[model samples]
Target: MKTILVIGTYDTKDDELHYICQRIADMGGQVLSMDVSVLGDPSAPTDLSKHQVAEAGGASIRQAIDAGDENAAMQIMARGAAALTAQLYADGKIDGMLALGGTMGTDLALDCAQALPLGVPKYVVSTVSFSPLIPADRLAPDIQMILWAGGLYGLNSVCKSSLSQAAGAVLGAAMAVEAPVSTRPVIGMTSLGSSCLKYMKHLRDPLQERGFEVAVFHATGMGGMAFESLAQQGYFAAVMDFALPELGNLMVGSVVHSGPERLTRAGAAGTPQIVAPGCADLVDYAGWQDIPAAYTDRPFHAHNRLIKSAALSGDERRALVRDIVARLERANAPVHVLMPKGGVEEWDREGGEAHDPQALAAMADEMEKTVKAPLGLTMLDAHINDAAFADAALAVLDGWIADGTVKLG
Candidate 1:
């Protein structure tokens, strides 16, 4: 039977917390409770007591009580709870985790959830499920957050429905979840969809045939976040970072962008990387929102109902070259950069809607000026979608594999 670790401030929400534990038990799933309460006692004992949690965080429960500020004391408890939760998962004592909370509980729950690795099932039943108060970086890439409606006061029927569903979801996830495969060396690649970026089509097969697993991530906001997280963990043997508008989006303050650590992680982890500016010419904006005044006069491409793009100016494209090159320069591993001289994205070709030859020329000129040795730079006389660009990227990968830069299985 799967075991779900239940976490909460058992002092006030004991009734609701116990109800979830009961549902899990009824479903033939075991429950291990951890109470993170600061003052009052839980209705019954917890598998991990408040005292244990406080002590694990490098303080005693008496010290937490003596500190006497709610937020400050809770921060201490959050630290302890996260440490213990990580230890529980590491010790193989918990299969999945479920937490119930309002703002304070949700804050601690996020810390606990992040303590576990990427694949672990982490569900948070909270008052603020998807609130803007919760930053994107605090969340585990795989966390499931459900609104804990009618769950604050007591165990009502509406609250019971949410609790039961969460219990079932966590248990089911634990039983059915498949860990990431590791039969061959994994290649982490980034790309936009085939329409905008076409190099992945030619590259995926040849890399796989070389006994490498090519895992391509879409370079949208959350997709890039996941890619960066995996790369930080040193999850890939090598990375082919082709499509790169997410970096540009982040630089331009677009919500459709990923977090700050996108391009730097693979190299920091010492993984060999063949980087390219596949979609660096455009900045993605949320299509549903009003177009920002700054980009109103620029060329636009409505990729879909959810996302749109605005072409950067010639000067902006030149600035992007410096940013991309600077990021590559900081990588701690083997790094080679590919610059497609003709154009980066599909819409930037001669007759395409967002085409601007001068902007492309400015970008190429800046790359030529800044990209230097120790970090390899290859300038190709082809569009990013052309066979020459793909062939050049594969050749770099083949050369890396032939050498000891990329370790194979």
Candidate 2:
């Protein structure tokens, strides 16, 4: 039977926790309840009490209860829960995990969820699943969350339905997930839909033929974050970072900023990386989101109901190029910057709405002037999506692989 860890501040969420525990049991799963409450006694029976959890975080239970500071107490419990959760997973006692909470509970649960490695099932039922209050950098790359609607304080019909779904989801994941088998070294690539699909198509087969697995990440804000996180974790043998719209988003103070350290991780990890200024010409926002006042007059394109993009001005493009140069300067590994002179995106070609050769030229000029070794800079006559650009990028990566600068499995 799958052992799913149930986490919560049982002092306040006892009934909800008990209901989910029973639901998981009904589904033929075992429960390992961990109580994280700091103040009052737990209403439900717990296998691991708050006292143990508090001590795990380096504090005594009595000290936590007497502190009378909710924030401080929650932070303490969160640290303890994270350490205990990792230990449980390491011991093969936790197959999956589910937690329910408002703010404090969600905070502690997120800590525990992040402590578990990727591919382990992690779910959080929270009233504030994707709220702005939760810092994006603190979230695990693959955490799944259900917005707990009308499921606070006690077990109502709505609460039961949500809880049952959480139980089923976690249990099903635990039963179905198989251990990952070792494979050829993975080459991490980033791109966007339609805008840079041609480059990805050209690179994938060639990289595979050269004995490396290609893993592509879409360059939405979160996609960039995940790619950076995985790179920092040493998950990729090399990286072909083609899409950079997230940087443009960050440049203009858009809501879609990938964390502050987006482009620097692969270099910090000493992973060979071939960087391209693909899709750096635009910033993306939700289709329903209003254009920021500063960018109101910029050229705009609505790709679909879910995505809208705006072209960057010459000044904005220069700022982005400088940012790229600054990041490349810090590389501890082999880095190459490929400049596509024709255009950077599908809409950036001649006769297109985003066409601006002068702006593209400015970016290339800035890179030439500012970027230095251990960064190599190359300017190509082809568009970013063209076969020529893909061939150039692959050749650079192939050279590194052949010279033992990048080792393949």
Candidate 3:
């Protein structure tokens, strides 16, 4: 029998959740309501009591609720709910999950829903659904439904229609989910077109050989954000950032800014990381036609007919170094920042049109000065594509692996 796991703070959202559960049961679907409230008792009866859910979450539910404020209690209850849901699914009990709430309830419910593996349809009906801040809709590879403008106990007609539609959608999705055959840890690689193939050749295969499935993301503004989001989603065990061209775009007011939290996710999540200066020296523009007047005199290299690259100037290089170091400094997990001194981009290499020794030196000096973390700094005197550069990166990773800086599992 397919059991639909309906989760909510029964104490706070009893009326709405009870309404949804009744509809699910009436639709001939098995409904299991899981109460996620740290404080008061649930208004609706549930398959799993608050104490049970808290136990499943590896915490004392009653204690957490009594000790914390409303916000803190919600966070605690969300963790418990997610842990309980994960256990239920692992035990082959939950077939699907549905959540109904405004922003706070939506946040807690989705936190639990995401615990289900990809393809297990998760739905959130929220009033804030129209102005969705949840990136799960856009980012997660999983199919997440966000039903907008879900009113509170509205006119019977409107409420019935919306609830019926949402319930049916969630039920259908749960029935269709394919069972996961494996739970391979995803490795996210941030690359540019110029260096993507190289990642496959040098890093991806090596990582797979060491038992990891690789997912490569472009270093464009959107691509970097998506890759980091996946890391925060706990979808990736490690991050290999090979193309960092977005730094130059961010500094130059280009359309390619990767936002403020570009390289900071893995560190915050304690995901093992390998950072690089790959494509760090240049910024790509639409074409030579869009090059700023001040940069018109600088050397330019045509990557293709449509894209042109220009190496950073001395001051820009220094700023890039500081930004890069700041990110590296914040990492709590095993981190290694490798600098390919021969050049950070193809054009900056010897005999390339965008080569600028002055800019390169300034960048390196800033790194030496700014990156004072013991053993965090790895300056390799080789071209990025050189076998030596690859060897150095692998060596740093291997050292971290041996030293237990990164969890071997």
Q: Which residue segments of model 1 deviate by more than 4 Å?
A: 62-70
Q: What order do candidates take by lDDT, descending?
A: 1, 2, 3
> Model 1: per-residue lDDT, tens digit, 1-409?
8899999999999999998999899989999999999999998899999999999888988898888788888898999999999999999999889999999999999999988887799999998997767765677778998898888788899988888899889988989988776899999999989999998888888888889998888888777877887888899999989888988888888887677777988989988889888889899887778888998888889998989999998899888889888888888988888999999999999889889888889988898898898888998999989989989988998898788788777
Residue 92 in model 1: lDDT: 95
Cα shift from native, residue 405, model 3 (Å): 2.6
Q: For model 2, how does the per-residue alpha-carbon lDDT over 1-409 read when each residue is reduced to its tens digit?
A: 9999999988888888988999999989999999998877776569989998999999977878677888888888999999999999999999989988998899989999888877899999998988867765567777889888887777799878888899999999999987544489999999999644468888888889999888888788778877888888778899999899898888877667677898999989888889988889888887778888877777778888878888888778888988987887787889999998888888988888778888888877776777777788888989988899999998899899889989986
Question: Runs in model 3 with CA error above 4 Å?
Answer: 1-182, 194-197, 286-289, 304-307
Roughly what TM-score does model 3 have, to 2 decimal places?
Answer: 0.59
lDDT of 3: 0.72
User: Which structure is stronger by lDDT: 2 or 3?
Assistant: 2
Question: Which residue pairs show backbone clashes in model 3?
Answer: none
Q: How many residue pairs clash in each candidate?
A: 0, 0, 0
Predicted structure 2: lDDT: 0.86
What TM-score goes with each of the models? Answer: 0.93, 0.95, 0.59
Q: Please give the CA lDDT of all the candidate structures.
A: 0.89, 0.86, 0.72
